[model samples]
Target: MRRKILGIALILLAGLCLCLSLNQADKYRQAEKTYDDILEKYTKEKKVSKKKQDFVVDWKKLWKTNKDVVGWIKMDSGADYPILHGDSNEEYLHTDLYGDYNINGSIFVNADNSRDWSDPNTIIYGHRMNNGSMFGSNKKYMEKDYLKKHPDFSIYRPDGCYVYKIFNVMVVEDGTYPYTYQFPDKKSYIEYLSKVKQYSYYDSGITVPDARQIVTLSTCTYINHVKKRLVIQGYIRQIREYKGMVQKRKINILEDNAFSKTEMEDTNDKEID
Candidate 1:
């Protein structure tokens, strides 16, 4: 009887382990559902708002649901994720956009960067899940072919849409000092770009002159150690007015080839969050 009882206990433990594994898998599904719901609601509201002037997202409604939401991120390769901003990088590191505690935390910007997307280097973070959600596709940037094929992604703000071209992609140690927003002078900013290009996986042959905005997408990668990270940086190539809808629309910008040169170009800069 003692042996039989021990065998039964072992079987029950196995069942419990299986259930826990299933629960973890379900978390990714839940994250997907949450994002879909928000997108659906945004679509509906966007349609309704077209009749009014100043076509922009219903920030009032979005804030009511989650004050952390700052803007939307969309990739040419079809990675569309909502960008959330919290008091600190840690706040949304483990929390979803809806305040739910999930391992697949919402895509978030570092607290060091401005919430308005005004910073010269706006770095965004997301988990690198095995299931290829969030920034999982970030690793593809390492391939020169992939970079050439899908060279651009865009950030949609309430005021307008900004298109960025992938200029450099790197796999660097976590907390790399060169990736921070602490650059004081224009010379330092140019030097930072040089370091990133020097360490990039591919030369990319793309450069960001001073005065142009940049965005960096970062994710975890287990390359010899868990602390290694994949970083993809891009410079703003174009900007268009939001046009009161989420679909692709175009507008004129102040200049073409804004970042084509190696020197600072004039910009009618404005603040955003």
Candidate 2:
């Protein structure tokens, strides 16, 4: 009789575990659908020419949904999502893009960094989910071949779109050099960059000189239960002015005024090639 009772209890425990797993899976599915809806609604691809295409985001529309919507990051490895900024770094650990709670949190920039991307080293953090969402695929960069194949990624902001080339991929303990947000001087910052490159799994042959900004994507790693992080660093390569509705209207009006003996020039926005 005791054996039979033990067997029943074991079966009951297994059933409970199965139910919990299924519930978590359902939550992930719902989270993914929410992000998919956001991507479909606010972003689109514009064909500049037969050979050139531009990825555009309606920043004005996105901001209406959430003022925290800072930018959108895209990579050729099928990693695309909206980036967010909160008052505190811990605010979005379990929050979704729609301000709901979920295990698959949105990719977010460090709260200490400037939202305008002016900081010398901007660090973005995301969960390394088991389902290969968020920054899960960033681990593939450890292999040099994969890094070479997908070397470039783009971040679109209200001001413009910035392209970055991947330069270093490495695993490091938490609270290390990669997490440094401020530099005391130019020489210290340059030395930090050199140290990070030396720790890379393989040299990407990309140099990040002084006065240039870099963005680092960081995610957690669970190797033997040690607290470590996988960091992928990239340097800015190009900057393009956002050519959306506002810019187009401004250009047309300026052209019409030019014919009427009125001269106007936009000296603020410039592209970095």
Q: What is the C-alpha local distance difference test score of each model?
A: 0.73, 0.78
What's the TM-score of each model vs. the native?
0.79, 0.86
TM-score of 2: 0.86
In model 1, what are the clashing residue pairs, if there are any? 55-244, 116-272, 116-273
RMSD of each: 6.8, 7.5
Clashing pairs in 2: none
Name the regions of candidate 2 deviating beyond 4 angstroms. Answer: 244-273
Which one wins on TM-score?
Answer: 2
Name the weakest run of 10 consecutive residues (lDDT summed) in model 2: 251-260
Candidate 2: clashing residue pairs, number: 0
Q: What's the true lDDT of residue 12 in model 2?
A: 100
* Residue range 11-112, candidate 2, lDDT tens digits: 999999999999999998988888788888998888988998878788789888889989999977657999999999898988977788978888999999
